[model samples]
Target: MLKFVKGYMESIEGVATYPMISLLIFFVFFVILFWWVFTATKEHIKEVSELPLKED
Candidate 1:
């Protein structure tokens, strides 16, 4: 099964670059997410975290 799928992928033209582009996109997304989490304010985090327990 694995060999069949690999052969199918290999048959497609310009398929190799797809994996690299997808990896670059995933890496960039996590980098931005980490930056946001680290730079977030402590007070803002506390407020958002307590929202679930607060009454409407």
Candidate 2:
């Protein structure tokens, strides 16, 4: 099954760049998410964490 899929993918033109582009996008998203998490205020984190226990 894996060999068949690999052969199919290899037959397509420009398929190689798709994996690189997807990896770049995934890396960029995680970097942004990490920056946001690290830079977030303690007060905001506390407020958000308590949201589930608070009444509507």
Candidate 3:
């Protein structure tokens, strides 16, 4: 089953770049998220965190 799937994938043209592009997108997304998480304001974080406990 694995061999068959690999063979099918190997037959496709320009398929290898897809994985690299996907990896780059994910890497960039996480980097930005990490920066945002670190730089976020404490007051904003506290407000957002307490949102669930607040009654409408």
- Give me the candidate number with maximum lDDT: 3
In model 3, the runs with Cα more than 4 Å from the true position are none
Candidate 1 residue lDDT tens string, 1-56:
99999999999999989999999999999999999999999999999999999998
Worst 10 residues of 1 by lDDT: 10-19
Tens-digit lDDT track of model 2 for 1-56: 99999999999999989999999999999999999999999999999999999998
lDDT of each: 0.99, 0.99, 0.99
lDDT of 3 by residue, 1-29 (tens): 99999999999999999999999999999
Stretches of model 2 off by over 4 angstroms after superposition: none
Q: Tell me how far the alpha carbon of residue 25 in candidate 1 is from the true structure, in angstroms, after superposition.
A: 1.2
Clash-forming residue pairs, model 2:
none
Q: Residue 29's C-alpha lDDT in candidate 2? A: 100
TM-scores for all candidates: the values are 0.83, 0.84, 0.91
| The 10-residue segment with the lowest total lDDT in model 3 | 8-17
**Preferred candidate (TM-score higher): 1 or 2:** 2
TM-score order, best first, reads 3, 2, 1
